[model samples]
Target: MVSVAYDGDEKTIVRRRFLISGIVQGVGFRPFVFRLACELGLSGWVRNIPAGVEMEVQGTAGALDAFQHAQAHDLPPLAVVTSSVVEDIPSIPERGFTILPSADGEKNIQVAPDSALCGDCLRELFDPADRRYRYPFITCTNCGPRYSIITAIPYDRPRTTMAGFPLCPDCQREYDDPLDRRFHAQPIACPACGPRLRLLDGAAEPVAERDDALTRAVELLRAGQILAVKGIGGYHLAVDACNPEAVRRLRERKKRDEKPFAVMAADLATARRLVVLENMEERLLTGPESPIVIARKAQNCPVSPLVAPANGWLGLMLPYAPIHHLLMRDHFQALVMTSGNVSDEPVAFEDNDALKRLSAIADYFLVHDRPIHIRSDDSVMRVFQGKPLFYRRARGYAPRAVRLPFKMPPLLAVGAELKGAVCLVQGEQAFLSQHIGDLQNSSTCDSFRHTIRHLSGILEITPQIVACDLHPDYLSSVHAAESGLPLTKVQHHHAHLAACMAENGLDGAVIGIIFDGTGLGTDGTIWGGEFLVGGYDGFRRAGNFLPVPLAGGDTAVREPWRMALAWLYRSLGKDAFDLDHPVARHLSDTEKGIFAAMLERGINAPLTSSCGRLFDAAAAVLDVRQAVSYDGQAAIELEALAEGAGVSGTYSFGIADGEPLVIDFTSLFTDLLADHAAGADTAAMAYRFHATVARAAVEACVRIAGQSGLDRVVLSGGVFQNRLLTEMVYTGLLDQGLQIFTHRLVPPNDGGIALGQAAIAGWQRGC
Candidate 1:
């Protein structure tokens, strides 16, 4: 029997009302609703409420059905729709859907965070005939500053920083027209009525205006003069890359050393000449965020060697703001754009702060009058495994919450040390903050707390539980504890695996290999090398690096000799290893004696299975590093030496019980000692060590995969950030015809830890 069901007639459609809560205020949710309503030919009104967006629709049953589907799936990129309740309303004789004035007194509004101007706005800004042409603040519904402009909820012009500047009649017309992209774009303004740009000399005297000011800024850069150029979220000291003196001067004045400075090139062509660009990389460089940094180096790229000379790759991002675009258009192709601050300090945002604090760094000033509410840094990205991984998520890619597959109660997660980011979750939406730097220092910790509060306000969530790294030494963890929210401690390696799983949308158990510098192990040891079989809810420890004594604790991080002494004791015992090489002279006799005693007695010593420490020991064995000047110096120099020596044959790493017995390296050390005795190149030894380590990892994975039914492997942790190791793993995994997963959207490093924390928290809550 065929059954036919009818609701009134095909033309008479039922109208339903919906109120969506969480991240639905300033992030273009209303604009998205307008588009969907128009597409579905629905009638009634849609408008913002203090708590969220409220909308009513009337249409054919199928049309309403389609609209509902699109409402959930076709949301704007920045919108994080947490909850929506649809109630059937009596059919209304409404002709067409229209945006209504926001209802006052409601309290669930989700203030959208500011986004960089979209491509559509850029097109209009360059259209010579447009009124907003050459405007520094050109914006549309699709993009332009949102969270930065907002002062209160309900996200209207009256409740924003833009409220001070009333829209002119022409702007009003464009803003009122629903058909236009600029319709209801609160920050919209023409050059005649918007913020103005000005150039000033060293003494703070005005030198030029508008386009001329921008042109002068470029000219100053070409002349090897340091100019403090105002950007979207803060000010940056800009200098010509070709000028070694300018770079040196800027670095000295900013009190920066060794650490690499980021560069901003004019466009794709200029960026291409400086670095190799892949298709996805090219698209990322020119896309809305324009954050993508290609890691390949240029052949004598004209930039001073002092600018990231120790590293092969240069950090490059394109001009995203109008002032930047104008400044880059003039003859110069690239500018050295580092943060305007002393090393380890926050980037300056205020006008007075820039002029006062950056006096020594900047030779000139390019000032503007658009009040910046929140300070943000330029987002940094890199291409790995043909995918873009974000190192720093700011500017072009922020406030855009990542939606979870399952819903959960509100939770906040304070991420790990180094490349820190905080996360706030409401229902299924997880909003991760922009890069919050190392929290070991007071300044960075302050930024971490401030950013968390600001992001929490935007998402309109009061976290029920706070998640943090199990490591108590991390300042972020302490801060999370003081917040008074229920604290949930997460294991570091588990969080790393969980982050990869969440990004890949995997919920089942899988084998995970996490390798990094160090983390507090569950058994009260240090872990940075681990293999586990797990899901977000829990994990079973399958294997790990064998722990060895660490001498001088923190001192081991700075001196490879300390780690080398410990490894030698483990590999060859107290009397079997030699320590009379010229490299041995680098350490003080007193220090060497202390290290040997510490290893033998285990005084103030801890054991760790960190693969990173293992690399440090090998690097030290080959005399790659003795006294380190920076973090990861030994490993970095080792990789550089290996790069020159090229790939070699596989080495063996035996399995004991279920775990891999890391070939103690005593034999390898003996061979290296013999080679040194025969006057062999130390570089080849370094290369051989790296090749051996990679082969060991591959072999271990092969055995594990065969024993377990799971064939998929997830490579995670900061250690995988090494290019040589990553390539070796990728090549070996593919050769085995196995599916592999690595990080793409978020970093594989600790920077991506917050997302993992959120995922685990959700699973814990039975989401």
Candidate 2:
């Protein structure tokens, strides 16, 4: 029988089968389709099949058209429909719209990154008349956990950690009712059936439960106590940001020094008082991702100085978790929301493990009975020219598939050291894991392996190839060497170059100026600042920074003075010590003799073409910093010093001709010393140095382009993370009539290297 519908006397019958994919499951897509079908007065059915959401509608052609339009345009907030396949079908006899049970098939569905607490859920949470009032585990179709709670594919409740808790009658009605907002909301539960909340003392024993626990937590925070609070992804050690002693106590206890900690404000209005926000920053803060947005601090901000000492910017985010919302409802303006770990270790998520690891650091523990299947730290980002620049991609961003420009075989890329992450690819979609900390110790290395298995298990990908960095000493590289899959080694700078290309969706080669601290060059020396021309297939070195000695190897990184001495020796030979420079004055005659010998004979010192070392040298020479607590601290301080200096002049340098042209800064360094001798303003000199690097970068690109016939330029690597340097180089390139591209989807740092490695491996394998 043919189903027919009358639209104002125009009787028509048609049928179409639609296949929708990409973040379409676990996001109320079925419920949305049900409502849309009923609205258009059509008869149809939708269900979750492993290949994604599938539906067939039979109705008047006009009504079907309206259904299609609404389905494409009006979508639920968290749902993302990536691809749709439509086909003509014979008319079917159907009475009304319905949502059918999920059927088994080949698993190929994308899980949405965890979302922030939605407004509707928030309203029900706080309403006195609501059944789930003040429920910390309150959630609806629009918001709450997704990736972090899933245990397997198709994203059904039985495949999640929530399977243990069966639904109550009231919640089951909401779950089954087609008209209800939470229809098919897998994690929906009222207080009677949901995860239990409690407050534990220092020894991990419960002191209070339910509402009393929340009140006790609020009281502890008001008394300037640190609380280890379990969140969607993992645990966070939280304290009042306005309490100076509390912030300091956290820093001292956590063994974290100068790296700024992210703070969670009660709301956007409170965030405005903490930092200066533009439209883009504000939107990102309140967006579904709910990342910590780095922004310029307001004048005399009330946040404790210890929160971000010497930093003009602060990382601020609004409450994302429901417990966070309830805790900050009326008690505090802001709270320190740093990750739950010591300075070097990975964030702990398991209940007992967190208790053992963070018990000393946290005065009390606010926990719940729900199990977090995967631990993801809060994502962090900064706005660059009205675009989001990620520092860490996790929680709300990880595990979301990024489509490739072309199809490729399945591959797994173990990312580089320092800011570790991994990329898994199946055909055209790439799934990147959350930030996995530096792969320096067994703890983080375990986390690295665990992340790979977790992502692979959930996505059902059997990788044909494994990719890693060229440097063999890295734990990621070592792991790749042992993996049973075929291996591909990717050069560090080449990976950086290819990462920018893949991110911008460019096929051909462009000029790549890659700058960072240290990467293994093909010639067995340390390479960092490099200029290359090529695409994903291959690359040729086009230019490089002048080689300089790295005195004392790793020690030169922590103490800028050693790198400064090396730069001075390279520029002026042994006579550099006789000068009246601060760096020269730091060493006595005997020390100078020993260091000069080290530089001359290359004793325990390796040569490097690193722009990162140059930043440290410049900082030390300018007396801006003597030693750094972190890797990029010197450059960050230099950028801060140069900002608003109100000076505009660049130090000129020369480009020495060679097979790979070398950018020589001897003249620039000499002139900088000349200015330092005159006791000039340090800020002005700092600005000139930044301008000099920018100008040199532009000139070098022009020279490379003149010879290589490439007009497009991509600036990449860790050094470009500097807002000052990146803006200057990008603007300078734009003025040269060149197409410029930079990192947007992934970070410019090593965190994004795995994606590049995966792309390059795909081409090498002839994908």
Candidate 3:
């Protein structure tokens, strides 16, 4: 450490100190820096500091300049350098580059998300001569699990789940060598000293070991038997997608009837045979994230229809885990890799938990010894307007910080009841949890609590403020109320608007069009279709849809026929049932009379202006689906029916100009009824109805923008999850010469609402 070097004249000596932030630690950044310094003939020492990575170098001016230039362009694949601060220092006598131990300080460094297997690692994994050949736990610094196994920081092996396994002598040699790829790779292990896999039957007794275990799992999959395979983040219930009987059996056992299942393909070539992929979709499928990309199904695809019954698009993902790669490469072309959870429950992650909970569904279990500290489901995405739109952000994307426009105090935001996710904000970064499923069930609720605790503990954040939705009955709201922190209750629609605003880095006022199934309104009714003018701190309701009775309340959500009756009665009076419509034929006289009495008397009826209910009513009226198996099923089917139809006509609506503008759909319903009476095609009417809604949204935005003098419009809420409707509204607003913002990094659904709640809480507290 005392060697000093001066290449030429003493006058040419120079020294610089640099501080790098953002995912610069735990990703072989120090080794990368050491190699660069050695090659440039510069002497430097790099070490991990709480703020990030710090380095000090002394060399000739030319060598220093080259090093600085390369710092920006060349970096380890996982090192995301967000900011770099450089300062000139007096030349110090240093001879060779060195990697020093990490120093303790205030923790501000970003944790890297899990990465896909890299090309070099894959080559070594498949090479027969390599020591780690066929090793499922083989990993290196450039590619491997990171966020899922981390317990505490400094990003060292002692602080990770791998601490229990001591490295073999040869592996330790590679880990200590600066030139080796495994140097400082916390999860590095060989087959001799790493986690092992085993195949177990329903009784949880071992049936096979190592290579034979994988072979047995493949044979079971090929024989149309479901196997719960433990993966990097969680467990996946795997079945052959081409096996109709197996898919149907799994669906029955899992109680998932119509929801589309995500499939894992062996490789890119295999994925192409099942779904169409564009350039952007291809990149997302094969990229480090390796999220499931929603794509249109290929013509004459070999997969069974039961895998994604009545769905036009299929969720496809290329293998990201080594075990997944090994399973698919030899046995099958595609496998149904759905989450290992019953309906409305969080995905199972623990080995014992998987055995106990999934034994009813899985014929066997292919599990490992490595522990997953926090469970993360596979992320789902779709390509829209030539860019990626996240539906569920998890797996290779969770726990990564989203930089805020301004600093924030420590805060926790419990997200919506449906599609639940929590947020922890510290300083300028907001760390959102992975998808936590709906919080209605006790198992999911417990998982949500565990996720909050685990994420907060690892990120070292203790919130002074707790935020939740205005709905008091929501599970998230209940959790926040009991948190014992200062609380802020954000309006549901406002949170949706604020989420889009925060993600886009907009601080000023914008016209927000929030449409969804339901949210507790300020007036004690239900709000779904709303127009608000607001910023992060607050918002004012500017417009909304006209109220209609939701007959039977929650029961109407399951049976769209109920919504159809409510809408028809409100639009066409007591004689609505006398009209010759398909909905009339489905409802009995006695049932209609009872439903009519409930709506008239307001017994068990809640007034709502929900656009989602409107879509459901239309689907029921058209006899497309009288009952739904899941949330948004009716609307999803309606959108699919309208996909390929060529229709330009749209219904008309009346807007009542007032303090809170009212959008009346009576005329639109009247037009739709006339078309139905004239025997208009259901597909054409569905397309026209979607177009009407899109046009109405643009008109409402224009009216709000004109009155409030806010020309920027932000589209959010679950209704915007409809691709056709979102695109139409986007193009319509842009054609009107308005600045429009939609979700990109965060989802448009409730999964992203926690970020908004945290932002609003921080802004309200003046943090």
Highest lDDT against the true fold, candidate: 2
TM-score, every prediction? 0.87, 0.97, 0.97
Q: In model 1, which regions exceed 4 Å deviation?
A: 1-45, 48-92, 103-116, 123-130, 200-212, 572-582, 588-591, 623-630, 658-687, 704-709, 734-739, 765-767
Candidate 2: where is the Cα deviation over 4 Å? 1-11, 104-106
lDDT per model vs. reference: 0.76, 0.89, 0.89
Clashes of 2: 0
Ranked by lDDT, the better of candidates 2 and 3 is 2
Candidates 1 and 2: which is better by lDDT? 2
Query: Order of candidates by lDDT, top first?
Result: 2, 3, 1
Could you tell me the lDDT of residue 573 within candidate 1?
68
Q: Comparing candidate 1 with candidate 2, which one achieves the higher TM-score? A: 2
Backbone clash numbers for all candidates listed:
8, 0, 0
**Angstrom error at residue 497, model 3:** 0.8
Cα-based lDDT at residue 475, candidate 1:
91
Give candidate 3's error at residue 600 in angstroms.
Answer: 1.3
Which ranges in model 3 have alpha carbons more than 4 Å from their true place?
1-12, 60-62
